[model samples]
Target: MQRFRYRFDLTSLHFWIVIIIAIISQALKAASVVVPSSNCYVLDNSSRIVDFGSDLVVRFCKDVESRSQTGYVDFGRFDRFNHFVAGSGQVDFVQGFYNGDLVKCEHSYDKLGRTAQVNIICGTCPNGQCKVGVGCICNVTYESTCRVFVELAIQCEKPGPRVFKGFTVGFHPRTWEIVYDGMTQLGFERSHQEFSFATEQTHVYLYMTAIASLSTLVQKPIVKTFPDIGLEVRLSGSGAAGKPPTTLSPTALVVDWRCEKARDTPYEVNITIPVEGYEPIQFTLTKMCEFTQTQDGDATRGWAIFGVLSCIFIILSALFCCGGFIYKTRVQRQHGIDALPGMTILSACLETVSGAGQGYTRAEDINSAFANEASWERPVSAQGTRRQSERKYGAI
Candidate 1:
């Protein structure tokens, strides 16, 4: 009889093994789903390529106001205008603009004094912290809030030796005085609709009434400049759409400036927009950067691997089934199950004995009381064994 062999395959084991491998690979592929965020600066694409010179932008703007020309100048708050005129006081509009009236040549002379024509420059000055050319301070308090200004210092480069006129004091700012009032000037007790921003866009439009600038080419930002050019800026801090970048640069903040590399050098354009908080709006930012395609080939590979493993598993299972069938068929053929049929030897012997000895017996004494027929079934050994012996060694 053929015997079943387990050496060729274990089908259940093969199927489970393939299944486990597929799951592990799929889990790893699923982990690649995080998006990282970054900030970008966008500038005016049209006009930002021009050369920056004087009567041009300063790195900073200092506001000088006249408290009193004769009083001790508050070297602290710029209450005294003369000190704000800076070391290059002989030059006009160097650190800031001159707004006060000039006086004619003073005749009064001290021991070593030769009378000099005295001129005054006023209107505004940064709080006394003044640098000759790099930047200035902003400490003018008007109507409860501070006015914003630029950091690029405006130096006097014109040909004449000019002296600044003194400042005009008191807060009755002229119709023109209210100009650089920043966005915080706009009441904050209001709501607005959602604004849209792209992943790496370069330009951002903010809603604030002030002057602020961020440049890609320049290091320091310019804030609160001319009020005639009204602007409003919203940063992520305000719970608005725009945000200043905290990483990547220390003082170089990420605002709404976009960098373009049209020429060999990069041109940066920064724009601050004007708006109230009640409307829905979206802005555009342009930038030059790299992008990645998100589609991955791993999933297709997973399917392919699964297919191969499944095919192997199926082939192994078929071989197992075929082996089992062949083994069972061989066992049945060798054992000859058809050869064993059950039979009663007594009946077959009786047929062959030709009524092997019809016999009559005397009745028992118990017949005197009541008749009792003697009945018996002969053992299968008796007649059938006699027939078999006759076939083998002649009748006994």
Candidate 2:
């Protein structure tokens, strides 16, 4: 029988060492997963991006009215049919919407990356300290609940890893109020389904009323500006169907207005709908609240003040030049360029050029002497006298 011997090659040993080191490095990195903390009360429907791995991240949101909190974790996106469970808590599925259209969850996973399946876990933590991946919050009067607004979970079929483009979470509490008195004033027999809500960024209202058919005009976005108040509202169809109408005259209209200064100053929302051959319906959804007009007035006043100051400066400069010219010519009896108000500056500028042909240490004085004795200063008859005498001698 042949003798069998085993010897490890040096190259194989080096390769094994490198592989072992990489595995240990990844393990250590996973062991040290640090979850960042944020103020729950301040984040209103905000989201942050996170990396994908065994380690997880946590984001907290709060509702001031209910005195409750919600935590959201972005587990990237899922490609295959996989069950996700929180490491330390329970997770439940959350519903999502697209442009006010409900995105219903389906049992079939054939929607590719078009459908998103998001899971949330709600609980309470001690002293505001909570573990990552588990949706928990502290300093709440009640237990924390998982709530979301417009969160997306796309299922992509691409071969590479999917990117987690952040999502928003928190309750968008929509409140509705009946515009009964206003509708009665507008002479509408049956006007209902009109309400409004305000946020820091925008103030939105929805107005719905029955009217005659508008002949294919329901798919356009209608925008009206109230220049007097520095505000505008864009009207679109409420998505009773999956798609919202791009324009006006839809069955339902959602009015979106920008009220960035809503808290600082009051705002008014006035909506009007006209029919082809029927009485126009009007809705004064909000009380007449004046937008602060002082800013524009202040701007106008500032520009006016700047114009006055500029005019005064120009007048003073002209007066100084005229006075200097009059004083130099009349009182000092100066003539030629010296009598001009700006002659000093002009002479200093031309000093180098005028004295270039003359050899002198002080160029300005030498040029002035040459100007005083120039041939042009002599009378025309005296200037030709020397030349005429030379011609007479030559003729003799």
Candidate 3:
């Protein structure tokens, strides 16, 4: 009986190289993580208070005749000087001397609070009656002249008039204008008064407030309106308008107000800031909430990195295979085996088996050949004897 044996070359460097490359490919595929974030939009720039005015108007009374303790006297028409009054159902007015001339003023009432008011009466006594036994009567029409002047010296604080979370405000250095972010400007109004000034016979007191419009930054259009959110704004400076004297201080002033409710349609906020010695300012801010946000890794970059690694690995694998083949071929050549061109390792192995079979000789076949040699020698000797006997018989 013949025994068969087989051996595996587990120690081959080429075998282990292939296993290492496969493990590396898997590790690169499992590397990324997910993250979260919010979406937002910002106001492009700050809103500035370019120009402002206190609308002033003056009205004078004429055709005056009165009876005094000096008895009945006729005084020709003369203008009456009176102080400007505001917030009074009576005409808003101011009294002062301009250029050494007494100036009595009254302004048209603005629902927006843009002007001051003063009242004046003018007319004549009915039927020239200078006295209703004592008092005088007039049936005259009133006349008013309007004038305007600009005033400055105003400052507003954070979360002004209206406050909202995540909202911030600032001032521009160059323009000294109000700056804000994450909000949009809508419009403004001016209607609060601060103080009065007397200059060279001209008595001037400004009654005005500034308003600005703004809204929150919205990335997309709202499908529907949300509930209203309330906010507050507080302001304080050297001369703040529309505030009580008790509330006025050198320090900051705060006022709380509700933000216009959020809605599908846009809404405007009107801010009213008063001026005393500085430029008046006003603007509107709108709040909008309608958009989605998400956070994630850069998928493209991650995949690109992974792909690059995979390509490198593939190239390395090719190089390793090539190096192993070359090494094997060289070793086979050194051992005097003919290495065929373009022959793979498997083909070389099959050829080696075929050659081994052709070179194999059985021990039994060799012993049988040696046993047949003696029989082959007897045939030659017998042939020679028969030839000699045939020669003798022919001689007899």
Candidate 2 matches the true fold with a TM-score of 0.24
Please give the RMSD to the true structure for each candidate, in Å.
33.2, 29.2, 35.4
Report the error of model 1 at residue 70, Å. Answer: 15
lDDT of 2 by residue, 32-51 (tens): 11121321111111111122
Per-residue C-alpha lDDT of model 3 across residues 1-396, encoded as one tens digit per residue: 122222234445667878888776554222111110111111111222111123223233342323222443222112243222112222111233222121232222422112222221112233454433322323332233322221111211221112111222222112212222212222212111221111111111112111222211211111111223332223333223233221112112232222323234333333333222222233343333222112123577788899999889766765666677788778878988645432344343443434433333344433433344444557777756644543211133
> What is the C-alpha lDDT profile of model 1 across 1-396, one tens digit per residue?
123345325666787889998897765322211111211111111111111232232221233433325654322222123222232252222233322211221121222111111122222234345545433333332321122222333332222111111111111222111112211111111111122223255434332212133212211222221121222222332213333212122121234422221222122222222222211111222232233222234678888999999889766765665565556556656887321111122222333334443342123321311211111144666645533432211323
Q: In terms of TM-score, how similar is model 1 to the real structure?
A: 0.17
Alpha carbon lDDT of each predicted model: 0.28, 0.34, 0.30
Cα displacement (Å) at residue 383, model 2: 26
Model 2 lDDT at residue 259? 40
Better of 1 and 3 by TM-score: 3
Better of 1 and 2 by lDDT: 2
Which candidate comes out best when scored by TM-score? 2
